[model samples]
Target: MASLNVGGLGGYLREQRRTAQLSLRQLADAAGVSNPYLSQIERGLRKPSAEILQQIAKALRISAETLYVQAGILDERDRGEVETRGVILADPTLDERQKQVLLQIYESFRKGNGYGADDGPAGEGGTSSAGTADAS
Candidate 1:
């Protein structure tokens, strides 16, 4: 795994906040963070936990996947999740609405399980999402 780009993440967050026209305090309030702590994150002085990232992503109305990639917690070029989405969209038997619903369900399961952009080889102790589903 690559070391995180904390400074880059901070810059991106700041940019997103500006684009949303939210003051730092407003964003911190929306994300359930302290103003000074959010400012520190903006200043690249603290490495935020994944939960904080999720909160910020939600508050900013941005996809957490993009933020994860920016934070180096997820690989940008990981194509397995992309491929899955593409396959769902490419299925001719399913209408676009059905495909969208399926994709949303798939994403919810992924989020619940803490899956990310990558689908590296599963460890013996860790089941792939498919395996987990099958076992259930």
Candidate 2:
């Protein structure tokens, strides 16, 4: 797992906020926090609690686990998979809604069957067992 300190966490939060296209004030409003507090968090001047992180993740429409990992509240279980998620989150082509949906589906598959890169729902050809593109 990456050793993410307050600075790293703050950077990660800033990146996510930018990716979501939300101003600090807007995110603070959505997360029920003060704008100054959110600013402090993003500037590495404050360490928010797990509850606050959860709230921020909700407001960002991202997985709370992702924030938890970045905040060092939880150790990353799978570095490769987590990196994949980071790529997905950081993809400039995909919109926030698309990214969120892809992340949700990926996480569900991981939790449901302990899937890895080699054991994805789709096979090597990138097609489902039903011989069609998997919409879900």
**Reference-based lDDT, each prediction:** 0.80, 0.78
Checking candidate 1 for backbone clashes, the offending pairs are none
lDDT by residue for model 1 over 48-126, one digit each (tens)?
8878998999999987777878888866745458657868999999998999889878865764464533454345333
Total residue pair clashes for candidate 2: 0
lDDT of 2: 0.78
In order of appearance, the predictions have TM-scores of: 0.62, 0.55
Going through the candidates in the order shown, the clash numbers are 0, 0
In model 2, the runs with Cα more than 4 Å from the true position are: 1-4, 78-136
Candidate number achieving the greatest lDDT relative to the actual structure: 1
Report per-prediction Cα RMSD to one decimal: 7.9, 10.2
**For residue 114, what is the lDDT in candidate 1?**
46
Candidate 1: C-alpha lDDT = 0.80
